[model samples]
Structures are given as C-alpha cells and as structure tokens.
Target: MDLREESLYLAPLYSRFPLTIVRGEGVYVFDERGNRYLDFASGIAVNSLGYAHPKIVDAVTSQVKKLTHISNLYYTEPQIELAKRLVRLSGLDKVFFCNSGTEAVEAGLKFSRRWGKERGKYRFISTVNSFHGRTMGSLSVTGQRKYQEPFEPLVDGVTFIEFNDGAALEEELKKGDYCAVILEPIQGEGGINPARREFIETARYLCDKYDALLLFDEVQAGIGRTGTMFAFQHFGVKPDMVALAKGLGGGLPIGATIINNRVAETLHYGDHASTFGGNPLVTAVANVVLEEVESLLPHIRKVGDFLGNLLRERIAPLDDVLEIRGIGLMYGIDVKSNARNICERCIKEGLLVITCGKNTVRIVPPLIIGEQEIKEGVYILEKVLKEGSG
Candidate 1:
C-alpha cells in the first residue's frame, strides 16, 4: 500500500512507519501483511498490558454497554472509584482528569497558578531538556526550544533550570517569585535521564520553604514503568502535584492531575472542568489498569533488573553503542549513529523500538513482558546493531 495515497486526507503531523498495524496480542503487533513484530515501544509507553488484554477488554466492553459518558455535573461510579484508588495510591487529596498528558500538565499549571495567585507568586521553574506538553501553558515550561520556538508568546513567567542542579533550583526558589517547580522524575523525551536523589530532595525542601508547589510529570515514567508506582517513590520524596497519563488506561486516552489538599482547597467549584474528563469508559478501564499495575509491581522490579543486566552484557559492548541510561523497564541506548535509522532497521527485523532525543533508542516494553520476550527483543537489537556497524 502506498502511504502517500492512504494518508492524503490526513494531517501531515507524524513521520509514520511504513507498515500498517492490523492487530496485536501479547507483546507483538501484526502488520497488514500478517508479519508479527515484537512491540517494545508499546505504543510509546501507553499499552501497559499489551494488546487485547482480557481484563481491559472486559472492562471496556462492559462499560460501553452500561454507560460510556456522563456530564461532570453528575457522578459516575467508575470515575469516583478510580479517583479514590488514585488518591489512595498517590497519597494525594484529589484528581482532575483530562484526555491526554498535555492536558494533565495544563491542569497542573493552572492549579499552581491559582494556588499561588493570592500569595503574589506566579512564575514556574522547569528544567532544561525537559518535555511537558505541546499546549501553550505546558509548552512554556517544556524547556525544549524546538517544541516551543514555533509557538512564541506562550504562558509567560516559566524559567528553565538545569536538570538535577540542586543549587540552581534553590537559588531560584529563594527569589520567592515562583508558584511551582515542575519536573519529570525520569526525563523520558529528554533522553530517559533519571533525576539524582539529592535533586528531588532539594526540590521538596525548597518548595516547602518558599511555599511553592512541586509538580512532578510522571506521564512517561509512572504506572509501574519504573518498577515503582511512581518514579518519585524511589527517592522517598513526594511532590505537591503529579501529572499522570500514557499508561493509565492501558491503551485508552486518559490524563490525571493528582493534587494535595492545600492546592485542592484553594480552587473552588467551577474553577476548572473537562467535558469528557474521567468519563465512564476510560475511568472504568483505568480502574482495572491500576489494579493490574499494582499486582505487577514485584514482577516489574525483577524483570527491570534482568533487562538492565542483559543490556549491559550484550548491547553495551557493541561498537556503535555509546551509553546506556534508564531505570526500571524504561531505557535509552545512545548510539554513535542516527537513532532513527536504528529504529527503522529494528522494525524491518521484526522488532519495534523508538528513538528519543538525538541519538538514543528508547525501550519501554509492556509491564507484563516476560524474560523470554525480553531476550527475543534484545536479540533483534543486537543483530541490528552488529549489522549496522558492519
């Protein structure tokens, strides 16, 4: 099939792969020609349970028959239950749901602004090389010039600090002009960089001292992706707010901004709302997804260690491989050559991976992936790297 002809009517936004996926099962996706490929990308970290998961299918199918959506003015059982579960797990007071990760970031930004408005604080401190979202507010704090340059005059007063620079964060917070310090515990789009423990601790301390909110963007690294419920758990420091999405609904679209009581109390009724936020369909699936993730936390930790060791022993020795960085199931293999070319070659060899940053190949397989599957995927990666180098 000619992609140009097939995509003539669609928006030219994505540089798509050549193959058209028709179905997926377990950790593999089948293209239109019925060729199966190990899907390590997992829809860019959204398919936590892989495709055609029985529980997710049951929840989605059952909910569609019962109730798919209802107004926020009315309460739905699934939405309420999921909110309670997230609140309990997050140790946060309330959750504001939206359709995607960017919306979650937008809500987090608004909540911090409103909470700090009366206190004469409005600026936001984000890190350099971080990615929040594409919308105006989230884009302003994204810290990537490539994503923000086209959309100038964004929500002002967001300052970009170096990631993991504790002194810079403290120096800025000392000014007492910022409302929030937004960070991604593991920088996903910025090359799978994990935050140093001391950096997060400093952020927590300074936020409390300056009365600023510490917002964590866990969209890419949350939901058992990092072997923990949330990436910040590894450091033993909690944030004032957390933005979650990507894997929350197992495949369905959902985003949530979990806030503490202090921020929740500052906002009154009608201050913010979403038309289809936390609708019955997505929330019901999210309930199952959360439960399944909690159960697999132990497995994730075990396999995450296995994967790390396997990569270091196998792929790390390749001539083109430069560096390996990641924690849990998420990893980035920086290569001496173009990462995009490597990803394309992997796709051709019946393995699916994606590129992050400039020369890094990112691997974020399903949380349920087993040792055998991991070996299969890594074998293909090794073959691709050797062939490319040769």
Candidate 2:
C-alpha cells in the first residue's frame, strides 16, 4: 500500500516521520527509496544489537523450527534458560516474563500490591515526571498528569513525590503509608534525567525504614544500555523489584519483572499470569540475545562511554545546548532550540534521532554501533546545528 493509504488506515497515536524505514543493518537503516540513515535512536532503544544480527536470526530461525510455542502450563527449556540467566545476571531470585515494558511494569505493580497485602499495607509512592507505562495500573503511578487526565480516578493511594528531591521523598516516606516506591534510575520518557545519588541512597534508606519495596523501572535503561547489565548496579542501590524490557529481547518483544526471593514469594499461584508470558519462542530468542550481549558487555560498556564523551565534547559546547545528562548509551541533549525541529533536521541529514521530555534530544544507538558510526552521526548533527543556528 501507498504511504498515504497506510496512514489513513492506522490510528493517529504516533506522529510518524515522513520516511518509511525498509531495512536496517548495524547502526544504519534504509528508507523505502534506499536512502541510508545512521540510526542513533535504535528504534527507541529497542534494538540492542542493531538490526539483523546473525546470532539473533539464527536463534529465532532454529527455535521456530524446533518449537514455536506451547501453553505455559507445561515446562519449556528456553523459557527456563532465559529466566535462569536473568535471575543469575540480576542477582534476583525469581522472574516473570511478559510481552512488553508495560506488561512487565504491570506485573511489578501486582507484585508490589501483593507484597503489601500479604503484609497488610496498600499504597504506592511514585516520583513526579516519572514514566512507567501506559496501562491503567502502571499509568496510575506514572508521575505525569497529562497521561492520567483522560482516565480519571486511577488506582487510588498513589502519591507523587518530586524526582531527585530527597527532602520530599523523606517527607513522603515518613508518612509511613506507602507499600512501594517505584521510579526509574534514569527517567526515559520524562527526559533523560538521572536520579540524584543522594536521592537514590535516601530512597533506599527510607524504603527500608518504612518497610516499603523500592521498585526500579529500568525498561528503557536496562540490559547493557547503561554500560552495566542494569542501571541500578552503577548506584550500588539494589531495588526489591525491577521492571525490564526494551533491549532485553534484542529485536524480539519480551518483558520481565525480577524480584528478590523474600519479596517474590508473596504472590500465590493465581495472583497473576499471562498466556504468552513465558512462551518458548520469545524466550528462546531472548535467551540467545542475552547470551550474545552478555558476552559482548565489556565492548558495549567501552563503546557507550566513548559515545557519551564524544556527545559531551561535541554538543555540550553549543550555545543552544543546555545540558547533556545521561550515562553510557542513553544520553539526552537539552537544547535551547526546538528539539522536534532538530530531530527533523537530523533525519534530513541522514541521521535518525528523537526527542524526549520538553526540550531534549535523546541519543540511543544500538550497543553494537562502532566509533566510526558514532563520529559520522555526530558530524551530521553538528553540521545540522550550525546550519540550523544560521
């Protein structure tokens, strides 16, 4: 179908770019007309290893041939392996897999509620400007009111605390009425804001003091995007629960809520479940993706750091650029100019980037991207900025 026809048929939920990406490899994606563009957003940080990695393709093909899927009622080797690897890597005791970041978050929410009910507590505290997911339950705790305005009277007992504000967090926790406190170590959709070190440490301390579970939603910043397998590792502040997705499945769709032993055991048999949650096909591919990335984690960390530094050096000096805040591969450039216009200019210059928050341009290239691609994209961005300024 033609572009216009396709647009007419689809919902207007997303403001799509003018170009249609037909194919991708490494850090480059090609339009339908074969115009190659350097991919800096990595499909919003979903493609961890870039497009068409040989290992991923091979695993998916082999798994498809062996077993596509079966009921979760029975055991599946791939699911078992993926769960084991995740638990091992995360130092978490149990794992429950689902289809997307939102589902993973929903699962975490359920666990938190159950963790509270089993102990007789039932409120949750989330930070302002935090973005969890779009589902009703996850959306309730999401810090942004714009998303919740349409759907009023969301899950009750959700209090909003200021992000990176230790004093406010301390005040809220002192109330001693919250069952869980969930926040992203690095807020993704609310702009690339990193949690203050003191705030994170304080959150941990307060959660302990109040017997509330501290949940980290690392869906966008997890699975090697932040140099470490998980962002919480960098802070040395382990959360009671973590919601993971995005890069976890490479190109495939997968999500998981990892929990500590003591906390995880709160859920009973029928507390929560999903048919495709632990299916063999998705898990098979996720297992391969995890193993491949785990083996190349050191390389990912090195390249991510190099890219972040390059961005800081190149864009941080611009008069219109306000700040560069992020770690490893997930960095955002706070621009004084229109971030949407800059994103369009980047697309025109053969580099694909996206905007986040109000005035920040987010950069999240695939972990396998090399220094050459990084330099090339940055060069394009710099040229665009110079011309845009003029």
lDDT of each candidate versus the true structure: 0.94, 0.88
Cα error, residue 280 of model 1, in Å, equals 0.3
**Model 2 lDDT tens row, 211-293:** 99999999999998888888999888989999998898887888999999878677789888888886888888788778878
How many collisions per candidate? 0, 0
Candidate 1 backbone clash number: 0
* Model 1 accuracy (lDDT, Cα): 0.94
Candidate 2 residue 362 Cα shift, in angstroms, is 0.5
TM-score of each: 0.99, 0.97
Residue 348, candidate 2: Cα error in Å is 1.4
What is the lDDT, from 0 to 100, of the residue 35 in candidate 1?
A: 97
Candidate 1 residues lying further than 4 Å off, grouped into runs, are: none
| lDDT (Cα, 0-100) at 386 in candidate 2 | 71
